[model samples]
Target chain A: MSQTDVRMDGSAETRADREATPGSAGGRRERLVTHRERADSYYGRPVLNEPTWKDHDIAAYLFLGGLAGASSTLAAAAELTGRPGLARASKVGALGALGGSLYCLIHDLGRPERFLNMLRVFKVTSPMSVGTWILTGYGPQAGAAAATDMTGLFPGLGRAATVGAGLAGTALATYTAALISDTAVPVWHEAYREMPFLFAGSAAASAGGLGMLAAPLAEAAPARRAALLGTAVECVAASRMERRLGPVGEPLRRSRLLRLGEALSLAGALAGVTVARRSRVAAMAAGAALLAGSACTRFGIFHAGMESANDPKYTVQPQRRRLAKKRAERELA
Target chain B: MKRNVGKVVEYLPFLGIVAVICTTSWLAGRSSLAGRPSLVRTPVRR
Candidate 1:
């Protein structure tokens, strides 16, 4: 693999200069650091500056994750209403999305089972690790819920199984934000508070999409409410992200794709909110917007993260701040 | 409806098997690539 071209803020001192590297913060040269060595060399050079996934690949991830989460949420809702068919459809759909998402996440890792390595040592500091645990919990819970249909022959224990499954399904609904927040990317990290709401909106949008494709109008009726709630949630998520992201959020609001997606989403969400109670067609339009908006969010967030990683300022500045604080402490002592 | 539900459950294991196969093939590909040696160049000579 090739080494990343990461440099510090001082272009004059950094580019093709020994003392410009952050590792040489003291203006003293150290041994040359390899890319692999730099991976764990905190406060040093970065090795991986970008994700390998294409735009479509990233959209697929957002789609599958949202679909899974939404379906799971809908499943819990259906169960509460005593609608077995809706509940069944939700479970089946959620499993499909979950299975697809699991594949994409592993595929995107470029090291596949390296995911297992993540599981070996779960760290609170690692968002990915926490996400892994969430998925692990959700998977079996969903499976058990699906299993309950068959186990209903054992009526005595079936109630317990159903209750347990409902709890798991709820967790499956919205932990994705936790994954995004766990990243070192400023745009996503700063928007952590808004991630759950953003993800919630996207999840509702996904359910709306699937309903458009599969469920009959009467069956999909609740999707209208979901769409409205999701639209409102997405609006809040976007506003919250903007309020919190400051400079980093500029990419989301300013980038052509992001802006277009957001506009369409707003239009779609507004239509869903205003006319969904009136017409099925409007709900469909809103759902489409949700899907588009959700996809845009993933694309925007991923690119922004990559941009944040690429610019020397994002990586170096944070480390420099830490180093400066330490030096000040030592000098004072 | 009951019969159809049974039939769906019956096919689930098959779906799980397919998912397992896909995940395995993907992981195998990943391991082979990560293990392979890709070339890297040295820094400019001072």
Candidate 2:
């Protein structure tokens, strides 16, 4: 993967080969293209050791993860309690997340039009490339399924759509972890087990926020519960990540961004639970906090991944040590 | 597919944006943007 070889102007590179970029940003013959291209060229630069994904990229992931997480939570809660209102909320939430995820996924791409090109060569090796395809596949299927909230409003085909969407939505809720877990980033990859559960919680809280903002206090009780549970999950996930990610996770442990994210998450979690018992307004406030907190978490994680990528120590050392150990064992045998 | 659908869906929300851009470019072209005298354009001999 060199970036310099690819010509952005001559229609999205139809060839399968990876493009080559110069070692330094300015070293290459700067071929200027569209306004967006010029802006994006500058956009990928790093000031920090690890530059987080773009704001839109982070925000889009946050929205989708939250929506997917929250909708599933609502679905689970609604199933238990037999509440159509809650169920309706879940479907709508899932659909919204689906649409937003699609937007984010597409918007985050250098070539939104050629997003499908991601499927050109599916490498189970590359988490980013794989995640792109997963996103492409899951987003629409799940979103369509979630549209059961509206699709069921139609006639004969509505029921079938509902069942199909339910199956898709179910898969969408938890698969978020697959996106991060399969990455080269050590912190995220290592935290794979917890990420799914953690995202599930954040998603629930996000749904709670929307529910609190929209639904009447009585109808939104499950959402409140979902928020509380999600908050707990997020807190636990954060703590576990802190403990597990070790030195490689220093960016997350030290950054001010992580601190803000922690504060917001804590505030949101506490507020959501307390307000659920107290007033509707309090619940709304908590929900907002949880939502913001989740956004921060996504941003923080994105930053950490970039950080992990930049420093060769973080990227190379573990693999080298593992390879050496394997070689020694083979020689001994 | 988003490619085909985006063609139709893409234009809906962005028409105003494209219009603004086109309008601005049209206006700029009509004016003397490239022609505007600058440090580079100033007489090197003088």
Candidate 3:
């Protein structure tokens, strides 16, 4: 391996140059130039620390939280519309997804008490704090609804719990966008305006996928509609976010996982629109694809943010652009 | 009277959750606008 000496001024000297220098230590004379003119940080190091969040744990947490929140809302709607089978399936899915989400969060925190400690204070500026409280509000209602539905007990109370969970569920579905975007991560923070809509749409798509997977074919029309609508919104919001971010969006655009997610979402939407309504097997396949797509999107976004945080150019270029724009405005004034 | 008390006890958890929601919402609204007096506009000079 060739060693390059990184200078404090963000320039690098190749091993060939070092060997050519008089009185330098011995090395092979290979005239390989690797340095290029671009935005760089001190010693070519990252300008910001990448988040320490474990990849699978936090990404799973995001996907499951969205699934749970949207499922709860879907459950409430189904119950109101008198679709018992869909309601029951959605309620149970919400509870299970919530359990998984909480587990992932607690696992990432390293302790259950640490997760609870987040509720010690609620600050409007702190998305994590608000999200913690939102989860606290949402969890029990989802659990009660699911338990009551499964056990056939407390019919009246179950309905109430479903409604309550539905109300909190909307916030749960979208607050995660705020949670991620509130960070200094370039990809996430720069896309803050569209992040919530993207997350909401992903959540809806996943919940619709779950409904179509578990519910009776006759009662799956709403799920089909939701899957299509959510896919459209998610696609539009994601593209808009990328367009608005320009060069800063490079990480997202370059992510293979994001590309796979978009392809899978589009395929699932097409399947749902065409053959899913006519065949149970097709519906199940489409539902699974949609669920996988939503998961991929969450993981893709998380990884893209990590990539942006670790790269000096992603940080430096955006800041320089902003400064340049401000200077131009000042000049015009 | 005993039945009413029992009923209240049964709904206690729900009530607690509601109270927390209300309190947090109020606090969040207040904190978001903390030190932002300009949001409350002064009357225009006639």
Candidate 4:
């Protein structure tokens, strides 16, 4: 007896031959077509390390930091213009958000003590270190402003703090883009030019949302303007980012959930800006939508980067293509 | 003049706080770098 009698079909067909067949065991032809031109990997695994940060904690931190930064700026504007209500609302909002952002950052660090290790060095190459210093400068100022507004003490001190916080807030809002884009992640790195603007717009919208929710309609007019301006900026930056990213932007395009969030955010912002003047409910709804949209934007960007990082083709093909193009250009020259 | 003086007095603590923060950050940076020697590169000789 020969040992070749183990076939269930009572034939001598090999596994590869069976798999390559058109209508064999599991419809193999379609699988072959699906992966026809895809780049190879180590057993189809990612070449780079996936981010170890938790999705909710880090994404929420990004959202809260933006909110705090924008609100601080709004507070400064309101204070300078003598809109006490808006100033108070924005200051309180900024302080609360900064507190939450700090909590989220520490929570994400897993060990709270390790958060101090980040403060041990100030390296220009590390965005996180610079961000920590910015936060250190901004946090106390924001807290003092809010405290003075609450306590009705040291008006001059509060004014100075607001001025300081406003300056730091701008850096805070824009530096987050640096934080994520400085990484080797293809999607984030590629969108470095646009991410800051996108983030700033979202932050402004978030601040506007806070203002409208906290301030009276008359006092919240600035909030409405900020929301509209922020949303417009966000939409423009997002469009440019998608267009310029080439194939690296595929993850962002293919992400239906992120797309849905952005659509909702934009529609909500447009509606809020257009109709909030007449209806307080509309204003409040717009605020809620803007906040949700900002959250979605952050999560979407984070997820897109993760998706790009998970695929080896995204990591390798872009570099290879760029190198080849450069070589060709050099030869022509 | 009195109000100006009072305002200046009030700001003393804030200024002091900022100074302390800067000093602390400077010290932290200094201490970290103190242990690590600078890696200056020398020109390659033929």
Error of 1 at A31 (Å): 20
Candidate 2 on A84-157: residue-level lDDT in tens?
Answer: 45555555555555555666666667576667777788887765666566555545544454454343454334
Give the DockQ (2 decimals) of all models: 0.01, 0.01, 0.01, 0.01
Q: Residues A1-333, candidate 4: write the lDDT tens digits.
A: 233223355554444443434445443323444444455344478878998876666776888899889989998998898667777777877887787778778878888788788888999989999999999889999999888977779999999999889889999888999999999999999899999999999899888876766665666778878888898898789889988998889998887656766776687678766887778678767777877787788878888999999998788778888889999999999
The lowest-lDDT stretch of 10 consecutive residues in candidate 4 chain A is A1-10
Model 2 iRMS (Å) reads 20.1
CAPRI class assigned to model 2? incorrect
Error of 3 at A241 (Å): 1.1
Weakest 10 consecutive residues of candidate 4 chain B by summed lDDT: B21-30
Docking class of 3: incorrect
Query: Which ranges in model 2 have alpha carbons more than 4 Å from their true place?
Result: A1-53, A72-80, A118-152, A155-167, A320-333, B1-46
Q: Assess candidate 1 and give its lDDT.
A: 0.59
Number of the candidate with higher lDDT, 2 or 3:
3
What is each model's TM-score for chain A?
0.69, 0.69, 0.88, 0.86
Candidate 1 residues lying further than 4 Å off, grouped into runs, are: A1-48, A51-59, A110-112, A144-166, A273-285, A314-333, B1-46
TM-score of the second chain for every model: 0.67, 0.42, 0.66, 0.72
Provide the lowest-lDDT 10-residue window in model 1 chain A: A1-10
